[model samples]
Target: MTPLVSVYIPTRNRSALLRRAIDSVLAQTYPEIEVLICDEASTDDTAEVVADYARRHPGKFTYLRNETPQGACRARNRCIEQAIGTYVTGLDDDDLFHPQRIECLVDIYRRHSPSFACSRFKYFQDPAQIERLREHRYSETELARADKLTLPALLYANLAGNQVLTELSRMRELGGFDESMPSWQDYDMWIRLADRYGTAVCTRQLLSFVDDDRSRARIRNSSRRAEGSERFIAKHARLMNADQKRNHRNIQYVMNRQRPSLGEIARNISLGGYKSTLKVLLHKFFGVAIG
Candidate 1:
């Protein structure tokens, strides 16, 4: 029998945190679901931890360990390739899901029949910070409209959250995640899906317990962020239309002025290309130029 949902987790060296993420899925009230974990060549004992869980759960949990260190995007793609379920959902290694997360999302998808769906998330620092978690409101009807799901809005606020579910076939059709992006991979995927299939259906606060730790705080440290943004803009420049691209270029111009340290500039430059680094230096020294 085909499972109702496949919860895909792409993890690296965060063994202890990964266990919590897995446990959250296992604790879900939704029964007809399988946990698919792709371990991206973690040097830590992540394999051993997953092995322990597999021994106990058997067929319910499927774990794949990679010998090579492909980033999270590739790991996610691997999970999609291995998954066998009617619907697919993603769970970050450090995030948690409410027991009803899958069930709620599945219900919304069935009712609306969207190509993709996302629910609101609550942010927290740790288990102890659960009390401090703040819920953000999102309108289902508003999100269903294309005008409201612009690229600028997406860039300003990553409203997609981590808990997104879509039909397995649609995911494959869209080529899963963009492997080239080291950061904002999810953002890029969402843009593609939105452009192809309209805005994602919102399911309110189904997923919960998003941890905003030092790692998340350092997302800007990604050596590929600026390059990824540029690449994303270039790849989807047409979709934004001429006007939207102009507006986005203006936003990028402003952002370049308020840039981070030289070290960050150097790192991103190395990761992206010398040309990109030169652009950054030019923007820093000479001010924003529309490219």
Candidate 2:
């Protein structure tokens, strides 16, 4: 039997983009899917758009509009709770899934039996002009195979998108996305899920992330990123090893401009040796970029 995949889209005020997202799901090669649209109290015609889809598609579409504007995490959790599918994934309102995305992901799950699976995806600026796609290319070339990700790697960066297809049961057991986080909620969820059951990545570009040109600003917004990273680190600090802690602190320093404590530096040096620790310190104080 085919598995049912639930694609939940948590959106607010992006009705035009939301239609594109919904259409992508509807156009998936995989037939067994339920598209859940969690509207965060959109004042626009989001309701009408969703209602029209419901009328046309019948059972394929599910809609829930919040009375007030809850954040993305809460909206996602609300939709996930109501989803009736064997596996589930999320799609940002501004993104699009390739035609074979669900079909490929579901096949990977069945064949590899991974707890959750993610694939490399491209990031493009504008979909309207297909020629402009070549102008800006953002693709994942790392993890070209199904390798188990380490906490250290994930601690430093979010290697995958929020569109990872995970088993509904596993997600619930791990406790869904951290609702308190204003950002990096997807990264936090990936760490927790990977830490528990291990993570595998498919070396295929099955999704397209429409970079709204907001990522740079979001990255530069040190406070928001730092707060979310701090929360994630605090929650999983006990499980992290010395190297992981050092990397986590390094990220904190880089993003938040918060200097690492003397004790932290000493611990990192003792564990990682002088050369690496010195390099990190130089990057921290001298503004040298750490790759």
Candidate 3:
């Protein structure tokens, strides 16, 4: 029989953390679920870890190890393609889901029949930090009155909440996750889905045990990643509405705001030499916008 949900996990060289993520999914109260582990040519023992689980669980776990390093977006696409359930949920290798996550989400989907659903998530540096992660609970009244959140807002809110279980038809219609982007690919897809289908039905506090290590944040802060996100927003700008277009533009501005301008680059290179200083003065006087 087809499973009720397919939990998709895309991992790199994070075998240890991947085990934890898988364990959480296995522990879910919802039994009719399958786990699809897509490994992006991990250098670590990720293959061994996933293989062990697949060996033990057999039909419940499907493992795919890509030969090339196609990045997380492609890995996710592979997972979606392999999913055999009515619903699909993304489980990041480094994140953990609460035991009730699948149960709660599936219940909402069955009752409300929303195209997609998202829940509140709590972040943590450590298990003890879980307390610090909790803030205000999401209010249904507020969710009803709120302007449908754009993908950018959803990313900023960190509330796209990892355990997405959208209908398979809707997901395929949205073209799955964009494989072109390495980071914020989920953001792009979420924006498209929200604009087209609607705001994902909101559930309260279904995700937990998010690790906020420095390296993860640094990866998010990288210039290459930021540029990629900006380019994605720009590429999709024309497809968005007025508010969504504005949101995408704002994301671009925010991503590029701290970069050095042409004048600043020339000044740094010349070390305030007479010619460079004169050039800067000329540009300032002419009111040139040197980006």
Ten contiguous residues with the weakest lDDT in model 3:
140-149
Where does candidate 1 stray beyond 4 Å?
Answer: 1-3, 131-157, 215-218, 250-291
Better-scoring candidate (TM-score), 2 or 3: 2
Better structure of 1 and 3 per lDDT: 1
Candidate 3 regions with alpha-carbon error over 4 angstroms: 1-3, 131-159, 206-209, 216-218, 239-250, 257-291
TM-score of each: 0.76, 0.80, 0.74
lDDT of 1 by residue, 22-89 (tens): 88888777789888899998999998998899899888788887899888888889889999999998
Better of 1 and 3 by TM-score: 1
lDDT of 1: 0.70
Q: Write the number of the candidate with greater lDDT, choosing between 2 and 3.
A: 2
What overall lDDT goes with each candidate model? 0.70, 0.73, 0.66
lDDT of 2: 0.73
**Among all candidates shown, the one with the greatest TM-score:** 2
**What is the lDDT, from 0 to 100, of the residue 80 in candidate 3?**
83
Error of 1 at 198 (Å): 2.5
